[model samples]
Each structure stands twice: as C-alpha cells, then as structure tokens.
Target: MAIHKLDIGEFDEIDYSLIAIHTSLEDYRLAYFINQKLHVNLNKSKKEIQITVKEGEAHFSRFHYYEMKKDVSWDLIQNKNEVIQQQNENNQSLFSNVNIEVATKVYMLPEFKKVDYFLKIENSENDLNIVKLQNTLNTIDNIATIYLVDTNKIKSKNNLIF
Candidate 1:
C-alpha cells in the first residue's frame, strides 16, 4: 500500500458556532430556560470538560442536546470553574507547614473572561439562525446578554475541543 498522510491543517478547519452568555443564574437554571425557550431538551452530560491549569485540574459542567431532525448538536457549557490550590505557609513564628487552600477562577475562553456560559452549535447543515436565537435568548428574564463569538479570535481554542 502507498503511504497516506493526512494534513494537520485539515483538522484545524473544524467548523462550529459559539455564543457567549452573560447571566447570574446557575448552570442548571440556565439550561432549564434554554430548554424551555428554545424547545430543545438539554440535559447534563455525564462527562465534564476538564482542563489542566497552573492551579490544578478544572472541570466545567456541560449540558448537551442533539436535534436529530436538524442535524445539529447543542452544548451549553459553563465558562468558568474554580480550582482550589493549596500553598504551604512558611512562617517562622507560627504555623510553618499550614496548607492554605485558595480558590482561583479559571475561564474556558480566557479571552472572554466576563462571559458566564457558552452555547456551542456544531454540525449544522447551514449557518444557524444566530440573530434570531440571540433575540429569543434575550427574552428570558434572567439572561443579561447573549451574543455571537468570533471563534477565529480566541487564543485558547484548544480548550473548546471538549
């Protein structure tokens, strides 16, 4: 058989749409509202999106729903996760070996640190009706804002592979 090689750039051409969500509501509650308003059943995924950071391993919650008819996949992912890091104290007079656990916020898309959640749409036949979706999402009383994200501008694109 002749040697066959796949170009690495081919994988980089993966197409998907990302929407940034800003809200104070909890992850489950937001999923509930999206399910109700969008008429899609989004449920918590058993496997979470985990990322290893300087602090530690951070796990982000994800809700998934597949619209078979439309051939589209919907994922509602939490943008932020808290990782606890323990640091040993080096005080001479008092406790020298005390481990201080500090919580640090990790962002899935550090470029958009202010965004609370992300709605990822994949495998759509055509470009999604993003403007209409944003309008519908805005109607939800709890949602503060929703907008399309430019995937090309994201520095930490690898974090979104999950």
Candidate 2:
C-alpha cells in the first residue's frame, strides 16, 4: 500500500475541507444517487468519466473499486456484530445534524487514478461545518468508507487499504 502526505503550507490560506469516499461501485452511480438524495447537481467531466458535486467529485476505476471492496469486506468480517450495530446507531444520530442546503463541491484527482474521491466545502464564515458533513457521509448506505482529513493533519497514514 502507498501513503500520501499533505503539505500544510499549500493549504494555509485555503478555507476548504476535504472528505474522501472509498467505494467499489461506479462513480457515476454513486454520484447520481448522492445528487438525488442530497438534492445537488454534480458536474460531469468531459476529459474523463467523472462526476463532481460542486467542486467535489467522484471517479470510477476498476482497480481502486476492487481494492476498496476487499478492504471493506475484511473490516466487516473482523468487527463484532454488536460493535457494528452500535456504530450504525451512532451514525444515524450523527447524520441528523447535516444541512442539506449547504453548498458543497467535489473533486477527483486524476493522479489518484479514480480511487480517491475528494469532497471540498467552502467553509466561508463556517458556512459548511466539517464535522456535520463527515457525519452525514458516514451514514450513507453505499459508501464503503469515508474520511475527514484536515490539510494540517495530513500525514503518512493507512487511508487507502487494498
């Protein structure tokens, strides 16, 4: 597995936050569902097949999809049933705070090879709360995994488990 670290200096003046979604499904399906469920219009990329929610986007690749699928399955098998149940309950509550009307954007980096889906929120005057956005995504049914990583906190971590 490869790990990538973020350079804090590059994002010092940026007031945006990133959310990553790891899944084994097609990006278009996921993007469309999210748009319908969240009531947002995610723009499509003409260069490559990608969907962006505002500036936040989702990409599809066979390699990453299979890798993430395997990892998610392994995680589920290793966890206890009760623990999973409790987490689901907590997620339900966590998603309650999400503001559906918040302006959100998605971007997918071509260098990542469609494996990583980055969600960018313009946090102008705290218009979009990172915590709430994270919670909302955590409850989504199809997403295999979701992460909220701050620019300052980026480091060599096992974010992508294949």
Model 2: per-residue lDDT, tens digit, 1-162? 999999898745645455666766455665665555544555444433334333344433311111232221101101000111111223367476454433332323332333345554433344445566566666667677777655555442222221
Estimate, for each residue in 1-162, the C-alpha lDDT of model 1 and write its tens digit: 899999999999857899999999999999999999999999999999999988889999999999888789999999989999988888885777789999999988888999999999998647578888899999988788899998889999998897
- Compare the candidates by TM-score and give the number of the best one: 1
Listed in order, each prediction's TM-score against the native is 0.91, 0.43
User: How many backbone clashes can be found in candidate 1?
Assistant: 0
Residue 39 of model 2, lDDT score: 45
Which runs in model 1 stand beyond 4 Å of their true positions? 1-7
Clashing pairs in 2: 55-105, 55-106, 56-105, 56-106, 56-107, 57-106, 57-107
- Residue 161 accuracy (lDDT) in model 2: 23
lDDT of each: 0.91, 0.43
